[model samples]
Target chain A: MSRRRPSTRTVLLAGLAVTVVLAGVVSFYASGHPDGLEYVAHSLGFGDSAGPHVSDNSPLSGYGVKGVHNARLSGGLAGIIGVLLVGALATALLYAVRRRAPRD
Target chain B: MHVPDGFLTAQTSLATAAVAAVGVGIALRGARRELDDRTAPLAGLVAVFVFAAQMLNFPVGAGTSGHLLGGALAAVLVGPFTATLCISVVLLVQAIAFADGGLTALGTNVTLMALVGVWVGYGMFRVARAVLPKRTASVPIAAAFGAALSVPAAAATFALLFAAGGAVPIATGKLLTAMVGWHVLIGLGEAAITFLAVGAIVATRPDLVYGAQDLRPDHADLEIRDGVVV
Candidate 1:
C-alpha cells in the first residue's frame, strides 16, 4: 500500500488545531514566575526600573480580558484571540511580501 | 526575553529601534524570496504557533520561567528571512494586543528576539549542519544546537544593550552572568522543543521543512558514478 502524505490544507489545519489547544488550554498551566530577564533584573536590583506599559489599560492587557473574572476563561480567550491576530497579521504580511502569482 | 520600558533610556531604545527597523526592512525584502506559493501558509502557521508556544512558560529553576523564543524552530520550519518576519509579527501582536512588552521597548524586543534570535539561530544551524552528517536526521540535531545557543545569545545581547543605556546603574558583569546562566537552562528547553518540533515535521513532511530541504531523499539518491551524469 502506498503511504499517502497529508495535503497542505490538512497539515495547516492540523497545525492550527494544535496551536489553539496549546494557547487556549495548556497556557493555563504555565508557570507564573518571572522570566529570565525579569528575574535577573530583580536579583541585580534593577527590576524596579520597569515602567508601566502604555497598553496596560487595554482590554487584553496582561493576557486576560479587561472585565473577565474567570482566570482560566480569560487567559484562554486571550490566547486564542492572540493566535488569530498573529495568524491574520502574519498571513497578510506574507501575502503582501510573497511572490505574486502569475495569473494575477 | 521581553525588555520592558524604563529598563533602558530613550536613547538606547531609539538606537535599537533604528536597528530593528533596518533589520525588518531587509527581512521584508528577503522574505519575498523565501516565501512563495508553497510556503506562505506554513509560514503563517509558524507565526501562530510561536505566539501560542510563547504563552506556555515552563519553569527553569529558582522561580524563574522560560518560554519558546522560537527562532530556531521558525528558521527550521521556514527560511531565516521569513522566520524573522514571523517573529516580528508575533512580537507586534503581543505588544499591541496583550500589552505584554512595553511600547517604548518594542524596538528592543524586536531587536533581541526577532533579529538577533533568528539570524544567530539560523547561522548556528548552518554551521552545525555543515559539520554533522549530511542526512535528514541531522536537521533536527542542528536545529536543536541552534535553538540552544539562540536563547543565551539573545540574553547576552540584552545585557550589552542594558550596559549601554540602563536606567539604573547595576553591575553589568553580574547581570550578564545571571542572564546568560538562566538562559542556558532555558536554552535546554528551547533545544528540546526545536528537536521535537523539527523532528516531527521532518518525519512527516520533509518537503515543508526549510532546513531539511537540502537533505531531501532525492539528493541522497544521486549516484555520480565516475563524476559523470547518471
Candidate 2:
C-alpha cells in the first residue's frame, strides 16, 4: 500500500486533543507525593544532597505557579501549560529542522 | 529519570553527551528518509502525547509517584527513527523551556530516554509480536510489556550512569536494587497507560499505528480470534 500521509493540520489537531485528554486524565489520577526518582534519592539518603536547581529562581518553580494557593489546581494548570508549551516548541523546532535544509 | 546538573560528574556527563549526540545524529539522518507526510506529523503528535502523559504521575508505594516514559509508546506509534527524534524533542523542550531536566545533562537524558528506552521497548515489542498470537488485541499486551519493561531498563541505565559518575557516596548495589525495584512498580503504571493509549489509538485509527504491521492482514479479515488475526 502507498504510504498514508496525515496532513499537518490533522497531526497538530490530534496532538492537541491527545494532550488535553491525557493531561486531564493524569491530573485526575496523579498521586499527591514525590516521584520514584525523588523517593529513591530520599531513601538512599541523597534527598537532601540534591543540589539546588538552577531554575529555582524561575517564576514557576517545581511546575507550579508561584502564589497559587490551591495545590492541586496549581499543579494541574502547570501541567497543562507545560504540555502546550512543549508541544508548540517541539513542533516549531521540527518544522524549522524540516524547512531549513540546504539544497541537495 | 531526568538527571539534574550536579547529579553526575563532568566526565560522566561528557561521555553520555557523546553517546546522545551520536544517537541523535543517526536519528536525524534516518528521519529524513522515514518521516514522510503521515509519519512526520504523527511523530510530532506522539511527542506531544508523550509530553502530556509523562506529566501525569501515578502513585506507587510509600506515596511515591511515577509517570510515563514514552520511549516504547513513541516507538510503537511511529517508527524507531522518528520515535527517537520525537522523544528527543520532548526532552529538549523539557530541559530548555521548563527546566524539568538539567541543561548540561541533556545528552545523558536523551541517551537514556530516547535511544536506550526505545531500543529495549521496541525490541521487546518486536519479539512479542513474532512469538505471541497474531491479533489486534495482542498489540496492547505487547505494548504493555514493552512499556513496563522500558521503565526499569531506564532506571538500570541511570543506575549504571550513577555508578560511573555518581558524586554522592552510595552503594551501587543498593542503588541498583532500589532503582530497579521502584521502577518495576512504575513500569506497571507505564504498561497500563501504554496499553490504554495504544488500544484507544488502534481502536479509533488503526492506520496511525506503525507497530500494527504485524497485526494487519493482507486481506481485511476482521475477526475476534485470540491466536488468529485480530
Candidate 3:
C-alpha cells in the first residue's frame, strides 16, 4: 500500500507546533551558563568590554517580556511572539521573492 | 556566535556591515531561483524552526552552552541561498526585536552566521555527498558532517575578525585556540541535531528535502531497462 503524503498545511502546522513547544516550554530549561563566545571572552578578559544593546529597552529584550515578574510566563510569551513575528516576516519576504521570480 | 557591541572596532564593524549587505543582496537574488510558491513558505517555516531551536542552548562542556546555528540543517532542507536568507531573517529579528544580539553587531552576526555558516556548511555537505553513496540516507550523514565543521569554522572566522580589529587588545593565539576548541565540542551537538532533523524529514517527506532532491525517483513510468530506454 502506498503511503499518503502530508499536505503542506499539515507539515507547516506540525512545524509550528514544534516551534511553539521548544520556544515556549523547553527554552526555560536551557543551560544558563555563558555560551562559547561569551565564555571565551570572559576567560580572555575582554568580556567586560561588551557594551549594552541599543534595543535593551525593547519590551522583549533578553527574550523576556518587560515588567512581567513571572519568569516562565514572560519568557514563554516572548518566545511565542518571536516565533510568530519571525514566521510572518519570513513568509512575507519569501512571498515577495517568489512573486519576483521569473516563471519557468 | 553573536558578537556584542563594543567588541570590534568601528572600522571592522562597518566593513563587515558592507560585506554582509552585499552577501544578503546576492542571497536575495539567488533565493529567487530556489523558492517557488509552494516552497516559499517552507523557507519561512525553516527560519521559525531555527529561531526556536536556537533558544534551547544545550551544555557543551566547561560551563559553556551551545545552540543550533541551523545552517547545515536549513541548507539541506532548503537550498543554501534560501538558507542564508532564513538565517539572516532570524538574526535580524533576534537583534531588532529580542535584543539577543547587539544592534551595532548585526552585520557581524549576519556575516558570521548567515553567510559564512551557510556557505561553509553547504559546501561541506556537497563535498561529503560527492564521496558518500548516493542513497537518500547519505543526505543526513553529509549534513551532519557539514554541521559539525561549520560551527568551528564560524568560530575561527570570528577569531580572525577579532585578530584584525578587536576593540580591546587580547592575545590572538590563545583566543583562537579557545574559540575553536570550545566550538569543536559544540559542533558535535550541531551534528547530532542536523543529522536527526534532516534524517527525519528525508524519511517522511523526501520531496520536501532540497539536498536529497536528486535521490528521488524521476517518475514511476520512466524506469531504464538495462541502460536502454524501453
Candidate 4:
C-alpha cells in the first residue's frame, strides 16, 4: 500500500480524544485510597511518614486543586492541566528539534 | 512506584541523582541523533498520548486502580533512546509542575520509570514479536506483554532503590515480593491499555508505529488475500 501522509486533523483529533478520555477517567473512577505501592507502605509502616517536603505547602498538594470544590472534579481538572502542560512541553521540545534539523 | 520525598535517605537520593544524571545525559545524546524530523514529532505525540493515557485508571483486583506507565508504549512506538527521553521529560514535568512525585527523588523515578521500564518492556516486545505470528495481532499481543511486564520490572527497580535508600527498615525480599506481586496485577491493566493503543495506531497509521512496521505490509497483504481490506 502506498503510504499516505497523516493530516494534522488526524493527530489533533486523536490527541483530543485521548485527552478527553483521560480527563473523564480521572474525573469519574479513580481509586480514592492510596495506590498499591502507598497501601503497601502503609501496611508496612512508612506511609504519611515522609520527612517534611520543601514544597509541602504548594497550592497543588496531594493531587488536590486548591479552591476547587468536588474532589473528583478537582482531580479531573488537575489531570487536564497535567496533560496540557506535558503536551505543550513535549511539543515545544520536538519543535525545537525540528527547527534545528537540516532541511531535506 | 512514585517515590515520595523523604522516602530515601539524602545520601541515597544524591547517589541516584548522579546515576540518573548520567542516564539522562546518555538518553539526551541518543535522542538528538535518533529523533529526526519524522520521529521527533511522533515521539512528542507519544509522550502526550502517554501523559493522557496514564490518567486512565483501570481496576486492579479489590478496588485498587492503576494507570499505564507508557514506558513500553513509548519504546514500542519510538525507539528505546527516544522513549527514555520522552518518559524522563514527562516525569520531570510531573514532579515540578504537578508535584505528583518528589523533586528529591526525581533521579530514582526517572531511572526506574524511564530507563528500566522502557528497556525491559521493549526487550520483551521484541522477543514476543519474534516468537508470535508476524501480523497485526502480534502487535497487540507483544504490546500487552511488554506493557504488563514493565510494571513489575519497574516495581523491582523501585524495590532496589528502596533497599539502597529506604526510610523504613523494611525487608528487601518482602518489599520486592509485595511490589512485584501487586504490580503483576497492575501489569495486566497496562497490557490491556497498551494493546488497545498499539492496535489503534497500527490500524490507522501503521507506518507511524515503529513496532508495527514489519507486520504492516504482510498484514495488509493478508487482509487483501482474505478479501477483508482495511
Candidate 5:
C-alpha cells in the first residue's frame, strides 16, 4: 500500500468503527454509579425532587432493550439503535442546512 | 450534565426550552456558513462519537462518575455552531429513546450542554490559543484547557438554573459549591480526553481541524533552493 495520507472517507469510516465498538460493546462495562449531577443532587438533598423520565417505558429505556434478558446484548442493541438514529438525524439536519453552491 | 426532569419547575423548564430554541435557531444559521460538503459529514460524525463516548462513564472517585460532554472536542473539530447542533442532536436522541434525560427537560439539557457548553468551551479555546504560542501543537493544548473548564462552567450554569426554578427549597450557595466541586474533578477527565482526541485528529488531519486552520503552516513558508525546501 502507498504511504500517502488516507483520504477523509477513510478517516471518517475509521472513526465510525471505533464509535460503534465503544457504544455497542464497551458501554456495558461502564460504571453503574450515578453521574456528577445526580450525585450532586442526592448529596445536596434534592435527589427526590427528580421526576420519572417521560420516556421511561421506551423500548430502549436506560440504554437497554426490553425483553433482552442478556444484559450485554440488551445494552448493546439499544446503543447501536441509538447510534443509528442519532447519526441519521444529525446527518440529515446538517446536510439540509449545509451551504449550497454559490450562484454564478 | 444531563439534568433529570422535575428538578426544575415547569415554568423554568419552559423558559429554558425557549432559550434553547433561540440558541438552536441562531446556530442553524451560523452552521450554514461553517458547513460545506467536506465539514458537514465530520460534524455529524462528531455527534455520533459524542453519543458513544458518553455511554462510557469513568469513575471520578466517591462512587460517582462523569462522562464526556464532548462540547470542547466537537467545537475543536467542527466550528462552535456545528458543535452546538451536534450536542443538541445527541441529547435529543438520548431523551427520546434512551430515557436518559427528561423530555420536558430536554431544553434544559440542550441549554446547558449544547449552548453553554459549546460556547464556553470554544470561547476558552480561543482565549487559550491567543495566550499560548502560535503553533499547531498549541491547538489541542488550548482545546484541552477549554475542555477542563467547560464542564464546571456548565455545571455552574445548571446550579444557577436550579436556584431560579428549582422545585425544592435548597440553599443555592451550597448547591453551587457541590456542583462546581464535583464537576471540577470531572473537568480534569474531560481535559485528558479532549487533549487525546483533538491531538490525534490534529496530528493526522490538521487540515480538517477547524480550530487549527489559522495556525497551519502556509505553503509560502517553504523556501525552495533548487526545488528542495531549504
Candidate 6:
C-alpha cells in the first residue's frame, strides 16, 4: 500500500501557528537583558564605541511601535508586522528564484 | 551577534561587506538549485519562523540573554544555501525594518550569522552524520551538535574580525576568551532548540526536513506501519 504524507497546507499552517504564537503573543515576555554581544561590549567598555542607528527614527525602532504606549501591545504589533513583512519578502524571493531555476 | 555601526573600523567593515556580497551572490545561485515549487514556500516559512523566534530573547546568565540565530535550524529544514538566504532575509528585515541591527553593519551581521553560522553548522552536521549510525534518530543528534558548535564558531569569527579592525583598542585574547566563553553557554540553547524543533518536524513530517531527507524512505515505511504517515 502507498503511504500517506502530511499535506503541504497542514505543515504550513502549523508553522504559521507557531510563528504567530511566538512572535505575536510570547515575545512580550522575552527577557530585557542585553544579549551576549551587547553584554560583552558593556563589560569590555567598548559599548560606547557603537554609533547611533540610521533608522533610529523608524516608527518600529527597537522592535516596539512608536505611537503605541502599552509595552505588550507595541511589541506584539511590531513582532507581527515583522513576521508578515519577512514572510512576504522571503516568499517572493524564493518563488522568483524557483521560477528561474532550470526545469529538470 | 549583530555588530552595530562604528563598532569596527570603516576599512574592516568595507572589506567584510565585500566578502558578504560575494557570499550572498553565490548563495543566490545555490538556493536556486535547492528551492522548488513546494520547498520554496517552506523556505519562506522558515525565514518567517526564524524571524519570529529571534524576537524571544532567553536569558543565559549574569544579565546576558540570547536568541535563536536559526542558522542551523534553517540549514536543517532547508538546505544550507537556502538557509543562508533565509538568515540574510531575517537580518535585512531586522536592520531595515526593526532597526535592531546597524544598517552599515548589515554585511558583517550577514557574514557572521548567515555565512559562517550556516556553513559551519551544516558542515558539522555532515561530519556528525557520517560518524554516527545511519538512522533517523541520528539526524537530530547530529543537528544538535552542529548547532551547538556553530554559535561559538561565529563568536570566534567576530573576535577575529574585531582583532583585525576593532574601532576601539582592546586585547584580542581577552575578547576571544570572553566571547567564546559566553557563546558556549548560548550554544546550549541553540542545541536544545535545534534538537527539539528538528525532532518535532521529523516526527510529523520528516519528508519536509532537508537534512533528514536521506532517511525519508525508511521513515515513511515506519510511519505507514504506525498508521501515522498521514
TM-score winner: 1
Q: Candidate 2, what DockQ?
A: 0.36
Listed in order, the DockQ scores are 0.73, 0.36, 0.71, 0.46, 0.68, 0.69
Q: Is candidate 1 or candidate 6 better by lDDT?
A: 1
What lDDT tens digits, residue by residue, belong to model 3 across residues B31-147?
A: 888899778877888999999999989998779999999998999899999999999999999999998877889999999999888999999999999999998889999999999
Question: Candidate 4: which pairs clash?
Answer: none
Residue B151 local lDDT, model 5: 96
Which regions in candidate 2 have their CA more than 4 angstroms from the true location? A1-15, A24-29, A66-73, A93-104, B217-230
Q: What is the CAPRI rating of model 2's predicted complex?
A: acceptable
Which candidate number would show the highest DockQ if scored against the true structure?
Answer: 1
Clashes of each: 0, 1, 0, 0, 0, 0
Candidate 2 residue-wise lDDT, B23-129, digit = tens: 98888777665565455666777888888787777878788888889988888887787788888888886776566778778898998899988888889888888
Please give, for residues B197-226, the per-residue lDDT of candidate 6 as tens digits.
888777777778899887754542554546
lDDT for model 2: 0.78
lDDT of 5 at B53: 92
lDDT of 4 by residue, B112-195 (tens): 888888989999999999999987768878988988899999998888888887887899999899889889988888888888
In model 3, which regions exceed 4 Å deviation?
A99-104, B221-230
> Which of the two, 1 or 2, has more lDDT?
1
Checking candidate 6 for backbone clashes, the offending pairs are none
lDDT of 5: 0.92
Ten-residue stretch with the least lDDT total in model 6 chain B: B216-225
Q: Weakest 10 consecutive residues, lDDT, candidate 4 chain A?
A: A24-33
Give the CAPRI class of candidate 3.
medium
RMSD in Å for all candidates: 3.0, 5.8, 2.9, 4.8, 3.4, 3.8
Off by over 4 Å in 1: B218-230
